[model samples]
Each structure stands twice: as C-alpha cells, then as structure tokens.
Target: MKLLLSFFLIFPLLLSSQSFEKGEKLFVEGKFNQAQLVLENYLKSNPNHLKTLEYLGDIAGQNKAWDKSISYYKKLENLKPTEANYYFKYGGALAMKSLEVNKIKALGMIGEVRSSFEKAIALNPKHIEARWALIELNLQLPAIVGGSESKAIKYSSELRELSPVDGYLSRGHIEEHFNRNTEAEVQYKRAILIGGSKVCYQTLADFYKNKMKQPDKANKVWEEYKNKNNKGIK
Candidate 1:
C-alpha cells in the first residue's frame, strides 16, 4: 500500500517532466519554432518553471529574438540568481543584440556582456563556456574598448585546467584571431585529437578551409563527423 501510494504521488511530477522532456528534445532537434510554441504554452500554466523558461530562452536566442531571449533568461535569473549558465546565456544574447545595433549602442552593452560573463565565472569557477566567452570578448574588442590578450590568456589557463577540449579550442581561436595561423592550426588539431566534441572537429575543418585553403581536408573532417554521428552503417 505504501509503495502504491508513493507511485501515485510521484506520477504527476513524472508527467510534468515528460512534457519538459518533449520540449527539450524538440529544441535540440532545431525545431525552435515548434519548441517555442510548446514551451510557451507550457509556461502559460507553469509560469515560473525554470527548465521551461530555459527552453523558451534558448528558442528565442536561436531565432535571433534577442530581447525575448534576454527577457526569459532575466526571469530565470530572478528566480535563481546564481546559476552560471543563466548569466552566460544572458550575456551571449546581450552580445548579439549589441552587434545588431550601432557602435554607440554597442558600447554600453560591451561592459554589460563582460560583467555578466564574469559573474557566471564567479558563480562557477569551472564554467568553461563562460570562460571562453570572456576570452573571446577580451580578445575581440579593441584596447580602447577593454580588449586584453593578457586577460584572455588568464581565462584560457583557467579553462584549460577545467577542460582540455575547450582550453585548446579557445587557444586555437585566440591564435586565429591574431592571424597566427600556424599556431592556430596546431592548437585546433590538438583539440581534435582529444575528440569528444563535434565543434573541435569543425574548428579544425574550418581552419583548413579558411586559412590553409584546403577544401579537401575540410570535407574529410565533415565526413568523419558524419561517420561518427551516423548510425545507419554497419
């Protein structure tokens, strides 16, 4: 009787999570419009559901509805202020919005994006993606706008301590940004040899195409990626 009663008590929660699961699956499959519809409808009833808000935020970001993405993520931040990923998403959306506007408008956002990314790192010292964002921002912006290769390398070191894949990937990007193609290729290839992430492979592939002028190498990487992910073959 106790077991049966416990099952009944947990069933509703399971059903709720299943809906969230479906929404997440749709989001992952790039059905952002459908995911937005489902998640938005779900939020109509569960107005403060964090995971649903996350999905809505992701869908909005994917669609380039930057303001809406910021809105959803802000609501989530209000609900749980310390989640590193929330701040990362908020900062990323803010950066995109900044890019869409004029320099004057973007100027105000640059500091905001930097601060939010920093806050994410403060909240989770090992948040690799947040660290990567900071590194990129620091490297991309000019000296007058607070660009600092020194700061970026600091973050890169911290990321390397946390994740080898992202560490080398970040290093490759940094090298590429400064036109250090030889070093960039070496770092990208190193990241690829680690081999858990598709992004690393694509980064190496893009380097071959864009920097080395090697489409054949790029195609080979793409084929390798497809082969690893495809399941229809023997």
Candidate 2:
C-alpha cells in the first residue's frame, strides 16, 4: 500500500517534468507558438514555475505582446527580488510598451522605466546592457525633459572601463546622433582597431555608406574585414 501511494504521488511530478522538458525543447527550437500552448498548459498545473514564466515572458516579448511580457516579468521580479535580469526584462518591456502608447502615457511611464533599469544596475554593478540603455535614454530624451550629452558620456566612460569596444562604439553613436560625423568616424575607427570583430567592422562600414555617403569606403571596409578574417588577424 505504501509503495503504491509513493508511486501515485510521484507520477504527476514525472508527467510535469516531461511536459516542461518538451515545452522547453520547443521553445529552444523557435517553435514559440507550439511552446506557448504546451507551457501554458503546464503553467495551469505549476503556476509559480520560474523557468516556465521566464520562457513565456520571452515568447510574449518575441511576439511583441509587451503588456503580457511585462506581467510575467513583473511576477518574476516580485518572486525573485534579487535577480537583476528580471528587473532588466521588466524595464525593457515597459520601455517597449511606452513606445506603443500615446506621448502622455509614455511620459507617465518614464519614471518607472528609469527606476527599473536603475534597480537592475543596483543589483548588478557590472551590468553592461543596463548602462547602454541608460546612455541611449539620456541621449534620446529631450533636453528639457532630462536628456544630457554629459550623462550619456558618463555611461560611455563606464563602458570604456568595462569593454573598450563598446565604449568606442557608444561614443561614436553619440557623436553620430549629434551630427558630429568626423568625431564619430574617429571613434568607430578606434573600435575597429581594438576589436576587429564583425560588429565593429559593420558599424564603421555602415557609417561610411549611410552617414558619410562613401560607398567605396564601405566596400573597402568589408573587403578588409574579409581579408583580415581569412588571415586570422583578429
């Protein structure tokens, strides 16, 4: 009787495990709609399952269902208050939602969006993406509303200390945004020299083609990258 009772009690857990593993596999394979169906069914039985909620939140975000994404991430943040990533995802969802809403509503959400990112940074002092987000936010917002080049540069400087490539790229981005093409070009070149990665090369090439109107330079940049990569220079 005791053995039968133990098996009965463990059966549901085994089923749940199989269900979630299938759902996670589907999610990893990018069959998000199918994964969502399976995961939602599992969630009905395991409502507070953290990985299930996280995968659902990611799928919702991928589908551009920002409100639903925010709801899941908010629950995650509440459940795991010390987890930096949950706060970051919650803030990212809020930021996307803000973009979809009216200007007044977006303005209303700004404080919370900023706070969530800040909270993530507080929890993880070395959070690179959070710093980048703050840099962009400061640069994009109107000066009257709180935008400041100095603030953007502050984050860029921090990035420099963390990763030289990101620092130069971000500084270049800021300069490009301010219409300082020459300064931007200098920064981008520095990044390519230091990193020589695909993104670094692409960033400089795009700047040359689009911003500086130099298609020949862009082509040359691509060719250079191909040649250097073939030679195993980077």
Candidate 3:
C-alpha cells in the first residue's frame, strides 16, 4: 500500500517533467503547433511555468502570431523583468506586427520596440543585435512620427563603433537618405575595403552614375564588379 502511494505521489512529477521535455524538444525542432498545444495544455495545470511561457512566446513569434507572442512575452516579463531577451523579442514582435498590418499600428509598435530595446540596453549595453535593431527601427520611422536624421546618425555611429564591418553598410544608407553624399561615399568605400559585397559595389556605381553625375567613374566600378562576379560562363 505504501509503495503504491509512493508511486502515485511521484507519477505526477514525472509526467509533468516528461511533458515539459517533450514540448521543449518539439519547440527546438520547429514543430510549433505541436509545441504550442503541449505547452498550452501544460500551462493549464502549471500556470506559472516560466520556461513554458518563454517557449510559447518564441513559437508565436516564429509563426508571426504577434498578438499571441506579445501576450506570452508579457507574462514572461512580469515573471522576470530583468531578463533582456524577453523584452527585445516582445518588442520585435510588436514591430513586425506594425509592418505586417498598418503603419499606424506599426507606429505604436515602434514605441514598444524602442522601450523594450532601451530596457535591454540598460540591462546589457553591449547587446549588439538589440542596438542594430534599434538603429534600423529608428531609420525606418518618418520624421513627423519621431524619426530623426540626427538620431539615426547617432545610433548608426554607435553601431559602427561596436563593429565597423557589420555597421558601415547600414551607416551608408543613413547617409544616403540624409543627402550626406560625401559621408555616404566614405561609408560605402569603407564597406568595400572591409570585404563589402557586389550589391554594395552596384549601389555605389548607381549613386555615382545617377546621383553624382560621374558616369565614367561608375562604369569603371561596374566593370570591376562584373569582371569579379560574372566570370567563366556568362
């Protein structure tokens, strides 16, 4: 009788652990629907499971179910506000939802994204991806709705300082859009010097030819790019 009681006592724990494990594995395998079902079922009983909430948020974000993702992430934030990743992802989902639906909605999402990113930054100032995303988001907004060329330049410069190779190309876009032609040229050239890309070369060529009215220079750059990439066959 005692042994049977002991087994009964331990069985629920074992079952709960197994459910979490299986749900986690399904999540890792990208079986989000299965994972979500398992996780949701688990949460019905174990409502305070932090990891389950995190995984659900991840699944929802991956599926682009922004509202669901935000709900799960909010639960996570309430549980552990210090964890920067949750905030970053929650903000990202909101930003994506804005883009997927309406700009007005997207504008609201941008505020959430900024707040989350800022919180993440405060928690870990060296968070490179968060910084990059912030810069990208700032650049994407219009001036009338809190977008500022100065802010873009500032964040872009900060990003460049962190990793010049990754940030130069992005900085070039900010410069280009702000009509800072000379700065843009310097940035594009820096990107090329630090192992840029064919696309970068093409962009620079177009800029020189059309915007700067320097066809000869553009042709020279294009010829160099074509020779390097369009080799052997065509």
| Tens-digit per-residue lDDT, 1-234, candidate 2 | 999999999999999999999999999999999999999999999998999999999999999999999999999998999998899899999999999999999989988888898898899988889888888889889988777999999989999999999999999999999999999999999999999999999999999999989999999999999999899887
Residues 38-132, model 1: lDDT tens digits = 78877877899998999898888888999999999989889999898999999999999999999999998899899999999899887888888
Q: What is the TM-score of each candidate against the true structure?
A: 0.80, 0.96, 0.73
Deviation of model 3 at 107, angstroms: 3.5
Which residue runs does candidate 2 get wrong by more than 4 Å?
Answer: none
Give the local distance difference test score of model 1. 0.87
Model 3 C-alpha lDDT per residue in residues 1-234, reported as the tens digit of each score? 999999999999999889999999999998989999999889988987999999998888888898999898888888899988878888787777777876666666677788998888788776677777777777777778777767767777777777775578778878877788999889888877775577678778887987789999899887877786667422
Ten-residue region with minimum lDDT total, candidate 2: 139-148
TM-score of 3: 0.73
Itemize residue pairs with steric clashes in candidate 3. Answer: 98-106
**Candidate with maximal lDDT:** 2
* Shift of residue 143 alpha carbon in model 3, Å: 0.9
Pairs that collide in candidate 2 are: none
Please list the C-alpha lDDT of all candidates, in the order they appear.
0.87, 0.94, 0.82
Ranking by TM-score: 2, 1, 3
